[model samples]
Target: MKQRPWINVIATEPEEIINTIDKCPSGAIRYSIPEGSKIKENVSNGVGNINFENTNLSVVKIKVNANGPLLIEGPTIIIDFEGKPLKEGSKMALCRCGLSGNRHFCDGAHSKQSWKPDQIDK
Candidate 1:
């Protein structure tokens, strides 16, 4: 009946369901629903959106841990050793372990490497 409106008159099923699985021609499956369609017209803003309700922006702060990655909190930017932007425009933990596969960014390498700070006599 979904295929043809005219066929519905002759259908025997008490109820009808017209479920559609749209597939693009290129082969990338349309698994995720488009945001615009699902979002309500007057819906309130949410977290992780680039545009924030609180326009007052601020720099994030970090605690230099005695040993291990810098425990960064609040808003900040991060870059990798290759000069590639890594997790920019946000707050994140940074590796001081020197063994991070991502380089300059913490891939949790401190745990595997067992990094500990050695205080030097200044």
Candidate 2:
């Protein structure tokens, strides 16, 4: 088997995540990118809140939407539905609501369809 390049992206740095776990914090670090998953960076959807995540791969800037997709960046992985390796790039979008037919990845459907729950006050 080829030793394919891979990077594990934990919301916080793995080191920090580990420390938090050791401290019995409410955080986890079992982050791992399976062989086949959609990966991307710099997506625009309306909700705006920047997040920086660091991994062995690279630094990623993400945006948090009250109810929207997860915008991701570099050190990304694009995989097929049948668990096949696609491409590794530096920009893409991932679905958060699990409504996209594309599944696992975001095709801008969250914005194109404007599919959010009726509760906006939450």
Q: Which candidate number would show the highest lDDT if scored against the true structure?
A: 2
- Give TM-scores for every candidate, taking all chains together and pairing residue i with residue i: 0.43, 0.37
On TM-score, the leading prediction is: 1
- lDDT (tens digit, per residue) of candidate 2 on 5-117: 22234456544433333332111112332344342222211112123233454576566545666655546566787888765444455677666676666544566556473
RMSD each, Å: 15.9, 16.6
lDDT of 2 at 10: 44
CA displacement after TM-score superposition, residue 52 of candidate 2 (Å): 20
Kindly report which residue stretches of model 2 are placed more than 4 angstroms away from their true locations once superposed: 1-57, 78-86, 112-122
Poorest lDDT segment (10 consecutive residues) of candidate 1? 17-26
